[model samples]
Target: MIESCSGIYRIKNLSDNKFYIGSAKNLKLRWFDHRKLLRKNAHFNFHLQRAWNLHGESSFEFECIEFCEFEKLIEREQNYLDKYYHLNVLYNLNPTACSQAGMLHNQDTKLKISTALKGRVVTDEHRLALSISWHKSDKCKKQNEEARKKASLSKLGKKESIETRVKKSIAHTGKKQKPHTEETKRKISETKRNKKNVNLIKGDIYAEPS
Candidate 1:
């Protein structure tokens, strides 16, 4: 039986001495929630969840580090976080206490996520759903367009590596590209002409004494 109290808590992994620190109004309820989510592998903290999965429940110990008033819960938790901020043993995904927003994952966590997603497969239904969701949002479409433009600008005058060129060649080997429509051709020609005019104005392209 756990005591119900407002306090700062630590969930420590006995195996590695790594731990996650948090505070709650009711320590007992919070501990219960953590265990429930961890058992189901659905904890909001992915770092803690992964560690719990790697090292069984028996390897973890939960304890109330300090009993504080409800108002001071966050402050107390932040103190513990600051104390261990530089250490690599903390399993906390967020550097700050009280809120999990705006926290960037460490490189180790990023590599772990990359490795976990490396061979994951997305179903056609899932892919279609994602496409539909993106298409449904005007903001997403605008942002995507902006990203494409930025990427196009960044790639200008850049040479691809030999390996990249070979991979692209292989990928497009059997693909047939559709011919541009007359309207598209006209637009392309106009764009090129405008670029040439700009370059001539800037003295980038030499005009032959005309």
Candidate 2:
């Protein structure tokens, strides 16, 4: 039932009887998330979205196959996928029967994703929201030295596009910046000396030169 929902859920297409299985920490929240996406015709899974648009929301059903603790959710979900694994015409878009928790995509998978996402357009409003959320996110607010180092390394050798630069400049047009204190400047200088891969632009004290 909805009151005590958790663990695995199945979204069944009543029209064809095909379905997809998934796990969540809170079943109620996950159901609403899927419903919102399907209603907006913006689900990440093209197969499911196409079905929803064709059959409409009334032709679908949300069923809780079972409930389990949060930690057991992935294992249980994997079991479900194995039970319903198909060779062809499967409803699931996920390539694996395993959970995605703490998973780092392999280079091949990353390249495939990058290729698949080529020419995808993000709306300006969505881009602005993402920038604001990333800056204000508490998840990275207390990053330790290791986390900070890893973050910096991941962004190494990346270059911003001219359009991105223009957008950033326009966004910062009226913003006032405070000068770095002497101690901050020393740390900056020390970091520059320690890292040979960094590029520094002439006038910018924050980022390396372009």
Candidate 1 structure quality by residue, lDDT tens digits, 36-103 = 76786666666787789898999999999899998777668878988996888798755666523234
* Model 1 residue pairs with clashes: none
Q: Best-fitting candidate, measured by lDDT?
A: 1
- Indicate the worst ten consecutive residues by lDDT in candidate 1: 96-105
- TM-scores of the candidates in the order shown: 0.48, 0.48
**lDDT (tens digit, per residue) of candidate 2 on 1-210:** 563455888899999988878887778888887887668655656677778889989999998988898777766886777677664445775534444456465676566557756787766644554554444445557555568899899989999899999999999999999999999999999988866444543335576657
- What are the RMSD figures for all models against the true structure? 15.9, 15.6
